[model samples]
Target chain A: EAGVVQSPRYKIIEKKQPVAFWCNPISGHNTLYWYLQNLGQGPELLIRYENEEAVDDSQLPKDRFSAERLKGVDSTLKIQPAELGDSAVYLCASSRTVYNEQFFGPGTRLTVL
Target chain B: SQQGEEDPQALSIQEGENATMNCSYKTSINNLQWYRQNSGRGLVHLILIRSNEREKHSGRLRVTLDTSKKSSSLLITASRAADTASYFCATDSGATNKLIFGTGTLLAVQP
Candidate 1:
């Protein structure tokens, strides 16, 4: 079985620009999550989706960050007017159930100049 | 937000030595899980100890959870160079089943 997959392993854009990252969860995985990892820090949850509905998103910065999971399979996270602080690794993970361990993707490393 | 903090932020050991990492977390949790991450890569699940379970083992790794102390420890016996990586502890406490991770312990095993 395939693990969670993320696209554009690396991205670089100027501040105030828009950037997007895509994720494809493993087949049969019902829960999907997006996380941000800064240097020397652990990954922080950004948004989580149970099937097609977002069940947790309080940590997301709605001012510029937006996320969507269409059809409960793949997900997309976008940052409009990216800020320098947004420069970090965006990781995607999925699990068969909420109680199970999550499988992570290679992550999309973004650099906002 | 981070829920746990791993002690000995960095450690170095010989290839055949045992390595131990400690994690302390705040609040009540349903489970505590360990994960390993190599440089520039995704995380790999190592082990999980439920709140009800005090100890668990897998291969050369052992994890002990002390709910009363809100602390956990991961011990890798006879670790090899391949074991060189960062280890993190994540806590599951919310109804959403989300995990709150710790900063992690960076271990280097010299061959």
Candidate 2:
């Protein structure tokens, strides 16, 4: 089976521009997650979805960042009016359930200039 | 912060040698997992050890968890150049679906 799939492996945009990343989780996976990873640091959770419901998203920056997992399979994370500090890798992962090990996708590397 | 800290930020060793990395977390957890990520690539799950378990082995990877100490260690025996990557430990909060990840250990095995 294929692992999680993400589009636009890398992206470059200027500050104040909007950018979005897409993710397609593994088949049959019911739990999805979006994470932000900075240079020399580990990934930090942005949001999580159990099916179509976003069960946890307290870490997400509501003012600029938004994420949605539609039909509990595909997800999109968008950053509007992006900032230089938002340059980092955005990762998507999925699991069969909340208790299972997650499978990650090759993240989208955003470079805000 | 919910993130954990890893010891020996970097490791370089000859092929066939053993490489050990440690991770320390601050909260009680239901389980701990290890992940490996090649340069510029996504992370892959390595191993998972529950709080009730102390040691678990998969192939050449051996993971030991010390819930009492709130720490875990991952040992890769007979390492190879292909093992060059970053290793991270993640702790499950047990209450939420979130995982607190450690800073990560950069391992470079020379062939």
Docking class of 2: medium
Instruction: Point out the worst 10-residue segment of candidate 2 chain B by lDDT.
Output: B1-10
Q: What is the TM-score of chain B alone in each candidate?
A: 0.96, 0.96
Q: What is the alpha-carbon RMSD of candidate 1 to the true structure?
A: 1.0
Lowest summed lDDT across 10 adjacent residues in model 1 chain A is found at A94-103
lDDT of 2 by residue, A10-87 (tens): 999999999999999999999999999999889999999999999999999999999887677899999998999999
Candidate 1: residue A109 Cα off by (Å): 0.8
State how far residue A29 of model 1 sits from its true place (Å): 0.4
**Model 2 lDDT, residue B81, Cα:** 90
Off by over 4 Å in 1: none
TM-score of each: 0.98, 0.98
User: lDDT at A91 for candidate 2?
Assistant: 94
Q: How well is each residue in B1-111 modelled by candidate 2, as lDDT tens digits?
A: 546899999999999999999999998998999999986667999999999999999999999999889999999999999999999999997988579899999999999
